[model samples]
Target: MSIDAFVIGIFFVTIHLLANELIPADRIKRLRWLSFSGGLAVSYVFVYVLPSLHREQHQLKDYASTFTMESELYFIGLLGLLLFYGIENSVSYAQAKGFAEYHAFFWLQVGFFAFYNMLIAYTVMASEIKGVQAVFYGAAIGLHFIAVAHDLWRKDPDRYRKVGRYVLASGIFVGWGIGTSLQLSSVMQSLIFAFISGAMILNVLKNELPKERDAHFPTFAFAIISYTSVTLALKYFFEW
Candidate 1:
């Protein structure tokens, strides 16, 4: 995708998120859903479909053919897993909170991350150097997992959900270490982390978030941002 298009997409997504999270109204929920759907549909049509149409008109192959089908399928699966967990968590939260208030905001976050990863993957595909692409992709996945882990850690430490989070983090780092040594496909490495993290997050948000005695937004945000920044910096400087 063009940088301009990507920036515009992010802007729309940011607006959707801010609206859903900060606004309070019955219509806000419906508006947020419509906005999210519209954003994703527009992005897919412009970035994926319109290009294919142009390719057909010019009798040229699809430019995105450079992206492996396996990778794309893996990303689709990742999206499905995330959506499943998101819906599941939303239901749980709705039951506890007596409304579907945060569901839109939750989905906004998911859409934002999905769009962010799509851009990152597009950038990786555009780069000709395989080594640099691998490092970049790996670093992105690593930072994502680190954020997931830190989010869990900021919740009540003694909560049973914390155990699941730790297990998920263990699986991620173990998979990362193995993928690093074996030079596994970036898509597969990302899936390994995605599944584990999604499962853990779903479990915690469902079973623990409602009853947690020590949940703090500041701590969660701090941990996620701090770890992500450190991971990104290390990936850039250490090439690991």
Candidate 2:
């Protein structure tokens, strides 16, 4: 494997392993940082992910037999959003009803996100994105993972520490392995990218848009403006 890709793979794994510890345990401090990270993720999504879909849509046209239209990727994106939303809603409902601590729901979330992490890592390798672009991708997703990990940790601290984290970390490396060993078609990659974009949007907003008392809008807005400026500068001046 190339050194850059290998390093990126390791970086992703490290994020999963260390994410829970990285966020503050104090509620106010935790929510503030969550707001910051959520902004970073949202900025990256709007600046990079949506545009990526437009570019990849052109390539999707080549595989039109199955998709019929390049815009179908948007439909796929919607499905991605709904899938995570359904999971989140179900978990909430289960918790409300007091379903025996909701172990099943917890595992359902962990399992989905493990595969989600795998896909994130897979795209890192398979897309062959490097240099500044890779750094931003890693940073945004890494911070985003921190937010998600914090949520999972809150759900069942003991269980997450015992089992959930390792599963998610392993998924990163497994995806790296698959990506390095086998390259997928451009169309397939585009489809995955679309799905991830939608999923990412939901995850970030869900985490960020907490009850007004729990949110820190100023911190979130600062992060969004700062990260957005950096990305836009890179795209226009350095053409990253």
Candidate 3:
């Protein structure tokens, strides 16, 4: 494996493992940081993810054997969003019902995120993202993971600490292993990218853009502008 990919993989694993420490407990601090992270994630989605999806769509179209397959990748992206939304909705519903513990739902959510984490790590190595560009991509995603892990921790603190965190953390290496060992076709990798992009949009928006009382708009706006500018500079000027 390339050192850059390995390092980025470790970065994700570290973020997952130390998320409790990374995210503050104080409401205001947490909200502000989460807002900033949300902006970064959103910026990456617009600047990198969506464009990459479109590129993948074009690539897919070149190999289309059937009309349905031409645009099916975007549908897969929607499926990713829907899958995560269903998990989030179910968790909220269980909480509203005064359920003390979401035993089954907890595992289900963690399991899905584990797969999500795998996709994230896998793409880091398998995709065209490399060198400095991977650093930027990894940073945005690392912050996004912090927000997601923190949410899971809030949902089932005891169980998450005991088992959930480690399972999710392990997904990073598992994906890294797969990337290093198995060579997936370009079409398969493109589809994986599309799915993760959609899921990432939902995850970032849902957790970081909290209710009015919990959000910090100024911080969010600043982060969005700053990250977008930097990313564009890298892509256009430096050709990263």
lDDT of each: 0.38, 0.81, 0.83
lDDT by residue (tens digit), candidate 1, 42-63: 2323333334333332331233
lDDT of 1: 0.38
Q: Indicate the worst ten consecutive residues by lDDT in candidate 1.
A: 153-162
Q: Residues 1-240, candidate 3, lDDT per residue (tens digit)? A: 788888888899988887887665544376787678777888888888888888888877667664346567789899999999999888788777877666787788999999999998888877646778888888888888888888888888888889999999999889988887788988789889889888987887777666677669998899999999999998898776
Can you give the TM-score per candidate against the true fold? Answer: 0.29, 0.93, 0.93
In the predicted model 2, the residue pairs found to clash are none
- Note the residue pairs that clash in candidate 3: none
Error of 1 at 41 (Å): 20
lDDT for position 229 in model 2: 92
For model 2, state the Cα shift of residue 154 in Å.
0.4
